[model samples]
Target: MTNDRRVIVHPDKPALASSVAARFLTKVVDLLDERPVVHIVLTGGSIANAVLEQVAQSSARDTIDWQRIHLWWGDERWVPLGDAERNEGQAHAALIDAIDIPEANVHAMPASDGGLTLDEAAEAYARELALHAPEGADTPVFDITFLGVGPDGHIASLFPHRSGIQVTDATVIPVRNSPKPPPERLSLTRPVLNASDRIWLVLAGADKASALGLALAGASRDEVPVAGIKGRRRTVFFVDREAAAEVPERLISPDY
Candidate 1:
């Protein structure tokens, strides 16, 4: 881990969600002021959705020009569009639909319903990313990437001991039989996720304590995907007290 890594512990889940949401909005506002366009990669999970919901409910949602912001997902279930298992579906109901962002700016991975096989879907997503990426790059330089740390120490669809976690050359890859349910998913590779300027990993509950501990302890990337998660500038773990139980006090930041 880098010296820039920070662990922020909140009193509880609600507090954690609220703080992350506020930070997200403020950061995006600042990015908008500094650049013409900003791209963010979002993750899916209970805590992640809670944060998005908080953003939708806040009056600060109107502070930025959503039209200039582009949103992408860190990973997505390879299910039909509108399926409850789809991350994009959960995201739309939680925040996207409530925001004023344009349809063209929302870069979602291809869905199974789009008549593409899992491999084809992954290829299509890579192509989409390349369109916005810099010259000679396969993926875009994401501004901020929001990721959820699984209790199993997985991030995106890259689970422990999985071949997907070992891949660094691809922009996106198809994950078959993921340790978690729905089996199939399309995930951006670590190279792509790590390309971001800031990485915010969110987690809650006592169930995640063990994984959080392992990750911060410098667990091998092949065994703990979260251990390899980092950004170009800053990497932060936004965890609730329950999930912070095993996180060393030394890594915990004093305040927001």
Candidate 2:
């Protein structure tokens, strides 16, 4: 959040997710209508899962050719494919399970069985993007990247006061000793995140108030990972009332 930017807050997580999903679908349809394919980077967490569920329930969902849509993860816990805790597994339960997206189009990071080291996984994901992305496209090449704001003001695996922010080369990196659980994880660095056409940050819960307030108050980038988002009009935040209670009235949406 910046002094010049506006925040869109809803009364609850469900409402926030539903509203954002509706808007996201419109963009998806427009992209497909103009091009042969659409690419998106997905994230994990409860709010994101809710958004995906809403997407699955949307009437316009079936209008898009699912097979023409390419999918990639913004981060992942280093675990077996389909493992209960894996972000890919959670996404499958929410949206992918209900869609006809092709297996080849869904690109996930190397699981434990991929026979690649953490560094290798990072390189492999980058190669995957290079193969499918349009010519001259930037690092990420994602049409839309969905993210979740952690209670600590972290986005993806970029934790506050952590070294993930300085990553410049590899779009993906293996994270060890994450302040959150599942220490061994892989995440999309800010370089890749900033290259996206659009970024939607979905945050909820009262526990996130202080961090949200700090983030919106122009906190230092190293202290609040959310500050890494450079929208220029391409970024938006979806927050529930409880999560925004600490924020000033001017920052909260009137509709909420």
Candidate that would win on lDDT: 1
Worst lDDT 10-window in candidate 1 = 1-10
Task: Write one digit per residue (lDDT tens) for candidate 1, span 1-256.
Answer: 2448999999999999999999999999999999999999998988999999999999899998999999999999988998998889899999999988999999989888899999999989989998998898877778899999888899999999999988978889999988899899999888788778999999999999999999999999899999998898999999999999998898999884
CA deviation > 4 Å runs, candidate 2: 1-4, 136-140, 253-256
Those runs of model 1 whose alpha carbons end farther than 4 Å from true positions after fitting are: 1-3
| Candidate 1 residue pairs in backbone clash | none
Model 1 TM-score (2 dp): 0.98
In lDDT terms, how accurate is model 2? 0.82
Q: Per-residue lDDT of 57-88 in model 2, one digit per residue for the tens?
A: 99988988988899999899887776888999
